[model samples]
Target: MEFFTEYGEASQYQIEEIIGRGSFGVVAAAVDTQTGERVAIKKIHDMFEHASDGTRILWEIKLLRLLRHPNIVEIKHILLPPARREFRDIYVVFELMESDLQKVMQVNENLTAGHHRYFLYQLLHALKYIHAANVFHRDLKPSNILVNSNCKLKICDFGLARASRDDPPLAIFWTDYVATRWYRAPELCGSFFFKYTPAIDIWSIGCIFAEVLTRKPLFPGTNVKHQLDLITDVLGTPSHETLSQIRNEKARRYLTGMKRKHPIPFPSMFCNADPQAVRLLERLLAFDPKDRPTAEERL
Candidate 1:
């Protein structure tokens, strides 16, 4: 990080405290020397199996460059070592955000009005803007969302992000980095389709929404098979066409084994769910990704 030492801002940054940590890297709070501004410094985990880990770094750059929404997190710049070392990687500089939705939900007693709807609306706005840019944020859980100075929501963590810009209008390809198990979408449960699309991100948004309402994860399944069971158990088995898209034969067999068209109809989990909220959840938890609503269409 010596290269960053002369960047001036980082040197003056007091390293107030450890903000958070994830598989990708450690987040630290720092003060800027040039302007006395507070910023969040995300130090990327450099010890990747190969050099390909830079893909997400590139994604953060591309996504930030294109998206300029009030709700989305703004990236200051990407920090590199001007000089290199064996394990040295890069860091992304962003204007500091004070709180994340997850923490706010826990601490605030009156979280229903300004805190809730404001963040939700901005989140949806950001979602729509990026989706229009053909960028799919594969991960949308609470920890990834940060609250800025004006109490606006800023989305972060582009590690699992993918783009629809690949040419010939290609499908939103699937990746294993579907955030956490609880936030995982139903369509991803049994598929390995190379053409997985942005619809999966919608399913994740639904999960996050439900989690915010209940202050707990909606489908906190233990494993992949269990995750599939939970999703199938909720939305019912997907159609043959949906099953056909998945390349994994095991996924096909699993779908074929379900004799009932709507195996999930019975045994309602949220029996007391409000009609409006239930409808939203249904749209989100749909077995077929095609059936799920786009992030923009939430309104």
Candidate 2:
């Protein structure tokens, strides 16, 4: 396993320590020698080892270059090693954040209602910008949201994002396994052939919001079938029209055969939650994608 000791010949940045690591790559904390600014550098491993992985990495870079919003992580620099064609690692530098939403929610016991509302507001503000750019994040979860002690939030990790056009080419199809299971939208879990839309991100936002309030995953399922069951248990089974929208025959039949379930009232689900917050959550988590409110509408 190789690790970076320093970045650039002039020692422009000094690697302090690794901040996080996941299947995608490793993120490290570093200080810019020129300006004495802290930055988080993500070293994407094996980017050029596979064509598909390289394409996704390139797509993420493209989207990040196009997205410019306070609520979205800013790319400070892109570093490529010599022999670019054969270079296996891709380094992307971003402004360092105090922590991610997941870690903040875990350790902060005295979080107020105001904290939750502000985080959600920033997320929606970022989503509105991304959606306006005709791009779907496809992956939105607590861990993907960065935060600061000041309560500012920025959305990150666009590796799974997809561009959405008014009429996307026929060859373009969204991958079914995009978002993490806990934050996945009903449409993604209910059918593999479901048409991808920005609504999926709204549903994920609803899940994240619920977690922020309760400090637990809204729907923690072990498998696809179990995931669908969890969703139905809360929002109730989809109507015949909603079921009909599922393009995957197997998934549609499986849903149709399930026993009917009455929807759980949002207020009851989110005990003591403000009525307006509950209402917004319900709209965001609507079973039908068309029924889900747009990010701008939620704001």
Candidate 3:
């Protein structure tokens, strides 16, 4: 297919095959003719179809431009349609990655402790940069993390991310459902008024780290209630003090009325994991967001 650089330079990229298709758009494997570099191009359709969609597209572009880190996906260039005013497609080109962490985990059953540590370290390294920019990746999961044969990992997909202020205002509800249910933080399960924080991403990282070790989701809940139940079952029921911190009355009451449970020790849960790794996991998975360590602290 024909493509052009932002500076109006004519370039040719042969689409090899369709790589992925999601709600946002289609991604395809391609090769740049001039450089012979393998690349992945995401063609976002109807980016300006609705006001909200246009806003989201712009937000993602802005964040990607600002975020520069080794562990984060790099945007090579943006290819707009020839006619800018009537453009219907937005193509974003990125360095091609061999696969995502989810697929890697599915096939690699003999992952070592060092592999787990390295993956978590790379993830936190990326988070350190993202959070340093006052940005929160609302969606963090194995699928969103790209991995190569060399075992290098990079964080991708910032469509759900938002700028977070140092002192975030309360009741600024962007979306009740932000993250994938399995990796979602407890506060996000049913709490409508919970403010955004980088700690939310830490909760997801904890879930991912657990999955890396066990080769399964830490909390595989079928729905919102079940998700919360799975989390509390392992972490134990939230204390009265923790409940008080929840801004959603309905969620707080639901958690409070649940049968009290003592936390299952991390070592028992991750039987073969490194003791220090388990300790860090516990801190990352704290019920209270305030108790969760920052990305820099985790690193």
Candidate 4:
């Protein structure tokens, strides 16, 4: 029978209201009594009775405790008191943001070239930080991005994540479960992505970049086949001639095996943006994840 105060003092942490709800938790706006600061508290469903999912939720604390960055959601404390919901006893404290990108996108004024640059730059900074920590977001969608009161964006979500630095890329770590369907890379939906390099993260980044530009998903694929189809539809199918240089048959399989189609860029979504940004999207959304741009090159 644990209590909130015994756990820590979020009483000073006034949870105002719910701002966001996810698969396993709800995020609310909170204010700190000690520092007179604003924050967000993510209350993960506590299912102490159910060990597997519960343990995984608890692991969020371990991962959050290890990471620190301006772009990634900042963690302040872990609520260790009485279990809540299905989670045994889990409450992860975070800095409250004014809202998430999803809600922000609803506003008309923020949808333009200028805001796009700022949004993308911030996302890059967050991804750079996660990669430096050797952690892959696995999920990188606009919905997962949140905006602080000052309009700074941060990346969130670590579930469905795996650490590859400790293991060689032997087999798929449940491919179907990796990342969101739309933002998922070619290899993720079909083949292996370069023995598990952080490059896959960049692939996800490319997808995200494409989405932000058009205000629509780069590859809004419903499944494995559709995923490839959506990509080829935009970038056009890769000719064996273009990929004849690829030695590994498995590596070539992604584009070759799938039915290629003509690419249709969605310029209608954006009014006035740099052609360079468009060019960059084409490169990032390549059929082959290997052909995707490096973070340095992107910058």
Candidate 5:
């Protein structure tokens, strides 16, 4: 493929095969010739095509450099371009993993309850460290979580992540680049609030937890409205008190006007889930962000 052939600058590594492809870039599994360590090299093509895209790439590089932890993906190296002032594609080398959580779940049906517990534990551990650093991974999903045969988990893709120290208003509209709709928190679905907190990530983890247990997306909505409907179908409608806290007038009016819904009992929804896990899921998916437990508290 073109990706394998256009790596003259990365001659230190032998590209094995293309592992993944997406809008951000192409990822290839390889082995470092000098160190003999297996790695994944991501080639981001036309990285400077858009100013915003370039800025996000810079932020991802900075965050990965600054936030070093066992549960977070480590960037081993970034191959320099031939020209300093002008470069279209950038290559980043990272620790190679067997697969991501999304693919693991698809092919492996024998994942036990213990596996789920450990996965959640590791994810919470990572979140605690990230939140402690004042950063929040806004786009969290099974695909963003890398895994190994030993079940080691690491969070990746920080392009959408932002620090909460100088918290900014989240985008109201759902976009291809933003958090995937199936995993997005309710507040993010309609721009329910002005300031978003780490709790938003908590909600995403809860959704992922459910998917880990069931091997299917908990809420596979066709659109924004359908996404909210699916969420309410399980969690029920938000209480007036919670609705009162919503800063967006239109969102509040929509929730108030919608038909009242009582929560679907967790036991019934996830028949095979452990009661203790169900309780934790409840707290993580609380309608009000304030009610959701922090990563530190959960760990």
Candidate 6:
């Protein structure tokens, strides 16, 4: 497939085929003619059309350059625009990967316990590195996790990621839809908490692991309220102290008015999963963010 638009730098790479497409743009697998190495070129079309999209692109590029790790996808190059023409589109080159975890989970069912352990290990290791740098990948989902056939994994898409601050309010100064709803933490379900921490990412990792084990989304909520309901259904109602942490008076009242829920045993919910794995999952999915383990601790 041909690129939607041409770039002078793209002439050096032999476009093999279109690999993927998303709301932002199209990704094409290509080979560097000079080095014979493969790469994935993402052409974000009309980047400036939406201010938020443009800002996200710049933020992602800046973060990728700052945070370098084996488990993080690397940006090889950014194709320069023409000298005189107004810049509208951008092409970014990244290391090629066979597929993302989302596709793998959908098509492959033979994943063993070893595979699950290794995947979780790599994810935690990557998160530990990012957290150490005071960076939080607000969006951590299967689609953002790229994997190779050799069992290698790398985290991608830092568009929604944010750098942590000493001030909790500034650190959590983000919109309610910070992450994909399926993997979002309860604290973010309806702005229940006044602040958020790296534990949000840990909760996301737990949700991802649950999907890896069951080959399905753990909390596939249809709406915000439904999402919280799905979470409470599995983990039960939050404790009074935890509920007290809710800064949103309306949200707190909503929960207080609801029928109390009893926690479902993870082993009962994930019957085929290993007991040891379920034990770890329970701690990861704790209602209170503080109760969750840090990526470094888990690693």
Q: Which candidate achieves the best TM-score against the true structure?
A: 6
Per-residue accuracy of model 2 over 1-299 as CA lDDT, tens digit each: 24652334325678898989987788989999988999998888887778877888798789899899999999998875756465777788899998999999899978887887898899999999999988899889999999999998999988889887656563355668788998998778865453577898999999999998888899999999999999999999899988877888889999999999999998987886777888888888898889998999889
What's model 4's TM-score? Answer: 0.81
Model 6 is weakest, by summed lDDT over 10 consecutive residues, at 1-10
Q: Pick the lDDT winner.
A: 6
lDDT of 5 by residue, 163-210 (tens): 665523443332334589999989988788766778989999999999
Error of 2 at 138 (Å): 0.4
Q: What is the TM-score of each candidate against the true structure?
A: 0.83, 0.94, 0.93, 0.81, 0.94, 0.97
Tell me model 3's lDDT, rounded to 2 decimals. Answer: 0.86
User: Which residue pairs in candidate 5 have backbone atoms (N, alpha carbon, C) closer than 3 angstroms, thus clashing?
Assistant: none
| TM-score, candidate number 1 | 0.83
Model 5 spans with C-alpha error above 4 angstroms: 1-8, 166-177
Q: State the lDDT of candidate 4 residue by residue for 74-186, as single tens digits.
A: 78877655344323446677776667776676564446676777877887777676677766668777677887656688887766555556544544353446777888876
Which scores higher on lDDT, 4 or 6? 6
User: Candidate 2, clashing residue pairs?
Assistant: none
- Whole-model Cα lDDT of every candidate shown, in order: 0.71, 0.85, 0.86, 0.67, 0.88, 0.91
Q: Residue 194 error for model 4, in Å?
A: 7.3
Q: With candidate 6 superimposed using the best TM-score fit, by how many Å does residue 253's alpha carbon deviate from the native?
A: 1.5
Between 3 and 5, whose lDDT is larger?
5
Q: Is candidate 1 or 5 superior in TM-score?
A: 5
Q: Which stretches of model 3 miss by more than 4 angstroms?
A: 2-11, 166-171, 192-194
Count of residue pairs whose backbone atoms collide, per candidate: 2, 0, 0, 15, 0, 0
